[model samples]
Target: MTSRTLPRLLQTPAVLLLLVWMLVPLGMTLFFSFIRYVLNSLRRPEWTSPSIDNWRGWGNYEYVLYSAKDFWFAVQNSLFIVGSVIALTVGLGLAIAVLVNRNFMGRGIARVMLISPFFVMPAVNAVLWINMILDPVLGLNGLAVEGINAIVASLQTMPIFGGFFSLWPEIEPVSFRATQTSAMAVIIMVTWQWTPFAVLIFMTSLQSEDQQQKEAAILDGANAWSQFRNLTLPHLARPIAIVVMIQAIFHLSLYAEIEIVSRGNGNKNLPYLIGEFASNNIGAASATGIMAVVLANIVAIFLLRIIGKSLMD
Candidate 1:
């Protein structure tokens, strides 16, 4: 066989599989979106079956856009969560990567511990953090607050400083399971899990730093901060973009952490919103799913442009 033909033959299975995987479900979703389909409908039994006779003609999209109360909220929340996580992971990852960049005792162990969080299942991370670490009455938050108060109480019995100590306010452990705080908890857990990923990526990038240039900078009286600001940061620009986009993709679809943390009490991202609508309103869910596709594509395009520009060099 010709070399070109051989390559095409070898790629056929993957190309066919990918086409099927992409088209089948998405085609079905499109078909469903244009029809009045539902799991159970007592008032209009015709709506229970998917058929061309019940064509919606953008009715579903309109209903999701205008009628659904949670659609905008979910979009905003999704962007907010993804944005916040990217900001934090990038910042913390840079600092931690710098901290562990130099040789130190037990640096390998520290790196292992830092990276271990990334491997934990999202469900387990949420459960462990919400119930064991952040629980108001049962977790370490409560115990630490109680301990602080006890210390303050003991200090209050001291001679001259007793009055000052007595005036100190008691500490209250934050209950992270409530509506607003539950979202915060989800954010915190997700950040912890993903920051390690940022660290690993940045650290790998750091290993490619120009050491001779760094040495020259030091010789030229460039301080650590100046060196980092001038050289290290510019070197890290591409990797930072890569990390941001990857994290954005992962966090935009965040579901298990949100589900396990607070079950979308007050913090439903787009995916969670789609899941909720899918329970009772398949048409709305499909419309929202299409919106999600568009949102993800926008991000993907922007990221791919950055990556492609860098690749050209």
Candidate 2:
């Protein structure tokens, strides 16, 4: 036997085990998606179990796509939250990475502090943000707005500026838990937690950047913006792609933050919707799970193309 044949034989068991590990659950999900499976069905007890006699075919898919009122909204909200979080994290990450790349006092402490948010558990992060930072009455948000309004009130009593200050309307603290703004709260808290991940990735990439090129650009009288645009940005292309791809995959499946922030009130993503379905209707939940898998694959493929192009460049 050839040397390569021995290696392949040794690797066979692991490859088969990995395949079984992935494919079994996937196969089960697919099977249940096509059958009328439920956790509790008193009216039709047979529907509670998985049986070929209770085949649903495309029924569950149709139910989710048309019968479920929130399916479309959940899809849209999922995309929106993912898109918003990715954009904010990338922008803020790049900014912070660049700022901290410079030599400054307490640089080590600053880096540690910046990355601390990422280590916080998702549920705890959401709780801290909603209660301590974003709460409408007791949080810093309320205090800051109240302070501004108080200052405006004090200024209105001044004779010369009384008329001008009166023109300033009292600012109300925004209720982030409300239906209209709950999604924004999810986006905000998620961005806060995940931006550090992007920062870490970009900061590492920046360190590997060729300083000789930067010095050359400086000698050529290139301004900060010019150096960033021409030299730094290109160097970070692959890293940015890596960040975006990973964040897209993760944020698409966000559940804990959504659950805690609003209990899936107006911020239901695909995963949250699946949980709602799984409470009773396993078939619908499985269907949703399959659809989520599809959506994730589509995004992964699209991002893979972009990452490939970046690597090629």
Candidate 3:
């Protein structure tokens, strides 16, 4: 009946609810990872069911790590895609934030337009970018390339300038859907969608920066780049770290965009690889899921350490 005791008791329900919410699926995933739980088996139909008799100690893990050809590539590609998106988003976000932080005409409108991408459904974003923007043959990419070639052709018709213009080769738009380039497509689209989130966070952080300190730095002959590099950047370190961590965690689970864009192509990340395995091999899929969780946790731990250090300073 003590005050503190009652407060702790009141919080217990919420804590228990959250634990159950997280632990149930996690427990199932772990259990499935260690057993032979395929979706179908014509000869050994019993293998389709989950039973103690189907125990497989470390076989699934071994298979995923050593046997599955796509597992390693998927993991590597996942990390590459997440890292590229984080770099591009943080860089573009910081620049855009700085550009729009100052008062200007239609600033509110511009902010809304930029943020609109973040709110778009992931599926729609994927469709729009792939079909309307990056399709090499029919999209804006091809059109722009064709327009440039036309202008070059016109310039080549000029008698004196013909020789000079003819020396230039014709350009072709790059196809982002192929195996060699699908990862780049995902990175570009995700960056476009997430940069606004970074911009919003950075802009908020910018407002809290000490203007007087900036003015003092200006008086002390610190130039624009110096102010940003020394003053503005240091002030934004925490926000930048937070933005990177959040984006990393989200992008690690990216599935829909990859599914749509890289369907037949050889491009695959952890989530996509898991989906492929899950088509028949439930055990392998669960193992891949566990591995993905471990990878994500390692990244999260590293990022949290960085954020902790930034906050402390």
Query: Which candidate ranks first by TM-score, i.e. highest?
Result: 1
Cα deviation at 55, candidate 3, in Å, is: 1.4
Model 1 per-residue lDDT tens digits across residues 165-256: 99999989999988778778888998999999989998999999999999999999999999999999999998998898878887889999
Quote model 2's TM-score.
0.91
Candidate achieving higher TM-score, 1 or 3: 1
**Candidate 2 backbone collisions, by pair:** none
Error of 2 at 267 (Å): 1.9
The window of 10 residues in a row where model 3 has the poorest summed lDDT is 304-313
What number of clashing residue pairs does each candidate have, in the order they appear?
A: 0, 0, 0
Whole-model lDDT per candidate: 0.89, 0.93, 0.92
TM-score of each: 0.95, 0.91, 0.93
lDDT for position 15 in model 3? 100
- Candidate 2, residues 215-305: lDDT per residue as tens digits? 9999999999999999999999988888888988999999888899888466698999999999999999999999999999987997888
> For model 2, what is the alpha-carbon lDDT of residue 298?
83
For 197-264, candidate 3 gives per-residue lDDT tens digits of: 99999999999999999999999999999999999999998888889888888999999999999997
